[model samples]
Target chain A: EAEVAQSPRYKITEKSQAVAFWCDPISGHATLYWYRQILGQGPELLVQFQDESVVDDSQLPKDRFSAERLKGVDSTLKIQPAELGDSAMYLCASRPPGSGIGTGELFFGEGSRLTVL
Target chain B: SQKIEQNSEALNIQEGKTATLTCNYTNYSPAYLQWYRQDPGRGPVFLLLIRENEKEKRKERLKVTFDTTLKQSLFHITASQPADSATYLCALDKGSGNTPLVFGKGTRLSVIA
Candidate 1:
């Protein structure tokens, strides 16, 4: 089965430093998502992309966080000045085209864990 | 504001027993509900989905039920094993192809052998 791939499985950085995480969705998937999972809490959506276009980013903290799916296939999420509260699991997920967002299931990667000191 | 709530933070069950987890939502009407499993330090894995029009859905030893009237969903795992121990999450989508799914803080289950 095709799976979403994520890099930098673990990352540690000082507060106020930069951090980045990458994700490659399953081939042919048109929709991609980036979510942040805090310890003991559910995953929260940070951004959503549809074929290289951003669909939703209301929850994203644009002042410090940014995400891009340049090719609509792989994506990158970056935090310019990391904060201690930013430490969490960064998850990437994808969905096939034509699958209704309300009904289709998400395929998630192993995730990139970040720790800010 | 939309809110999702799971029954508890943790649950303990013996091997071969059935484990039931609950999810409730308020201030929103979801078109579909989904269940996911997450091991420590790992991303969530989709397990099952039930639609608003559907009352029940089952896959092997896993079963899910959606009650739109009550605004709740129940996830059940039968004949559970130690490997089944993990955090289970419930997600909801408003059914409009426009919005993303929202998740609830998961319930961690410990299936002892």
Candidate 2:
């Protein structure tokens, strides 16, 4: 089965350091999303991409976090000066376009875990 | 602000029994409700999706019911097994037809033999 791909399944870094996570969505999927999952909380949408363009990022902390889907197929999320509270699971998900059968279904990657010391 | 709520407490049940999980939302009504399963250290796996117009949907041993009037959805796993033990999350469309999903904290189920 086609699946979303993520890199650096686990990462640990010191506070005030830089960290990056990568995700490659399933082929032909036009909608991509980046979410953060705290230890005991639900995943929160950090950003949404539609074919290389960002459509929603209101919840993203622009001051220290940045995300980009340069080709619309894969995306990268970066955080500079990581904080202890930033420790969480970074998840990537994709969905087929509006015309596809699974209209609201999302295919998620294994996720990248980040821990700030 | 929109919010989704699931029982933070763990549900302990025996294998072969039925496990039911609940999800409630406030401030916005979703067009569709979805259920996902997640093991530790992994991302969520899609399970079922029920639309606002639909009251029930079933797949294999899994079943889901959406109650729009009550603003809640219930997920059920029948004849559960130890492998069925995991955190179950409920998500909804960003309230629009096509947008990112908003997820709930999820309910943890522990199925014992």
Predicted model 1 interface RMSD:
1.5
Q: Write the per-residue lDDT of candidate 2 for residues A45-77, one digit (tens) a residue.
A: 999998999999999999999999987789999
DockQ of 1: 0.73
Q: lDDT per residue, candidate 1, B16-112, as tens digits?
A: 9999999999999888899999999888999998889999999999999998888999999999999999999999987677467799999999999
**Residues B52-101, candidate 2, lDDT per residue (tens digit)?**
88999999999999998999999999999999999999998744645778
User: How is the predicted docking of candidate 1 categorized under the CAPRI scheme?
Assistant: medium
For all the models shown, what interface RMSD does each have? Answer: 1.5, 2.6
TM-score for all models, in order of appearance: 0.97, 0.96
TM-score, predicted candidate 1 vs. hidden true structure: 0.97
Top of the candidates by TM-score: 1
User: What number of backbone clashes does candidate 1 have, counting pairs of residues 3 or more apart or in separate chains?
Assistant: 0
Whole-model alpha-carbon lDDT for candidate 2: 0.91
